[model samples]
Target: MAYSHVSKKNGVAYYLHARVTPTANGTRTMYFFAKEVKAGDDVTKALDEVPAGYIVVESDATGLPLLKKG
Candidate 1:
């Protein structure tokens, strides 16, 4: 499962997702969600609210979350 972290910038809350890649070298990457959420929000619940048509994937090299058009 993917996990998310909440960060605030310029009064806006960003949901960052971390995902692990399945490559020979385990890599992790951080992806920024398209929208800003409320502060102190739950990461897991925020993930479920990701906008439609977008999917979270892992980067082969960095193992970070990659936001892609799906």
Candidate 2:
């Protein structure tokens, strides 16, 4: 299953989505979500509000939570 990374930049929240290219090396592409969460937003609560069949993961680089498909 694919996963989406959630990150906060300048007090705003964004989502990074991974896209795989049909290339010989299978290059991966990252994209940002169209929506943004305002500052002071509860990230943990947002994670918990995710619907079923999805899981939250921590980003190794940012230590932020990411949403992934189960």
- In model 2, what is the error at residue 16, expressed in angstroms? 14
Model 1's TM-score against the true structure: 0.37
lDDT agreement with native, every candidate: 0.45, 0.44
Q: How far out, in Å, is residue 28 in model 1?
A: 26
Q: What is the Å distance of residue 10 in model 2 from its true position?
A: 15
How displaced is residue 24 in candidate 2, in Å?
28
| Residues 4-63 of candidate 1: C-alpha lDDT, one tens digit per residue | 433222332335543334556765433364344334333323344445676756555545
**Per-prediction TM-score, please?**
0.37, 0.33
**Model 1 worst lDDT run, 10 consecutive residues:** 5-14
For model 1, which pairs clash?
A: 27-62, 27-63, 28-62, 28-63, 28-64, 29-63, 29-64, 29-65
lDDT (Cα, 0-100) at 61 in candidate 1: 57
| Per-residue lDDT of model 2, residues 1-70, tens digit only | 2223444433334443433345577664332232343232222112214446766665667666665788
